[model samples]
Target: MILTGMIFQFNKDSGEGLIMSSKGATNEFSASNWIDTSCEPSVGLKVSFEGSDTLINIEVLKDESISIVSDNKKYSASDEQKMEEFSSVDEYIEHFKSLGYKLAKDTDDGKVRTASLRRFLEDGHGEMIITSIDSKITVKTMVNGKEVK
Candidate 1:
C-alpha cells in the first residue's frame, strides 16, 4: 500500500518529502524518520492523514500544517498543451483543469461561453492572477497588483 500525504518540498536530494503521517510529532520528523512512501505529496494538498494516531510534541502538529507551510510556495507550472486548447468550449473547460485550476461550478447564464472561475485568485486576496488559455505557452503571474511578465 503506497502511503499518501500532502507533500511539501520534494527533496530530490533525499528522495522524500517532510511527511506528516497520522502519528505526527510523537514520531520524529527527521528525513530518516519519514515513515511512508506513498504518492509524492503536493504542497497545499488536503489529503487523508494516513498514519497511526499518536503525537509527540503537544504543539508540534502546528509544524505539520500543510496549508501554513504551503503559504510560502511562490509558484507552480501549468501544462503548456492545455493553455490554448479552445478548439471547443468543452475543451476550454478541460483546459482550466489542466492548468491546475478547478472547475468550481457550472451554471448557464443562458450563454454559449462559460465564465470560468468566477473567483479565481491564488489565496482569495488576488495574490496571483493566472490569465492564460490552454493554447498559449506563456503564463503571466500578477503579484501585488502588478503583472509579472
Candidate 2:
C-alpha cells in the first residue's frame, strides 16, 4: 500500500527515519528504501512510501509551484490568489485570526481600534474586519478594505 506521511524523525548520521502517516502510524525507513527523490528527507516534510507496517521505497513529495509575480507591492501574486479563495466570510476571518489577530476593541478615545489591526490583515493582502457590537457580530471581507466586486 502507498502511504503518505510527514517525516517524524530523521537521523542525518544514520540516514534512517520514521514517518508518521496520516493514519497515525509510524514506520521506519532507511536510505536503502529511498527510490526516486531528488531531495533528502527531513523531519516534518511530507513524504510518500509504499509499505504496510514497515515502509519502504520512501520518497519526498514535491509541491507543484505556481509561477507568481514578485514585486515591491503590499500584495504578492500568491497573496492575491489566497485572497480570492474565500467562499464565505467565516472562512476568511478564521484564516486571518489564526495568523494572530485580536478582536476589534474600543480605545480610550471612543474609537474602534481597527487602524493598526487593519495593517495586520492588509499585510497579507487579505483584509478581514471583524466587528462585535453588543453580542451581534459583523464580518467585512475586502482586499485592502475595498470590497471585491
* Predicted structure with the largest lDDT when compared to the true one: 2
Instruction: Report the lDDT tens digits of candidate 2 across residue range 22-52.
Output: 4445578887788865877776666667888
lDDT of 1 at 87: 51
lDDT (C-alpha) at residue 136 in model 2: 45
lDDT of 1: 0.34
129, model 2: CA deviation in Å? 32
Question: Which residue runs of candidate 1 sit more than 4 Å off their true CA positions?
Answer: 1-62, 67-74, 77-82, 117-149
Candidate 2 lowest-lDDT run of ten? 64-73
Local distance difference test scores for all models: 0.34, 0.52
lDDT of 1 at 31: 40
For candidate 1, lDDT tens digit of each residue in 28-81? 223444333553333333233333443112222233454433423223333332
TM-score, cand. 1: 0.29
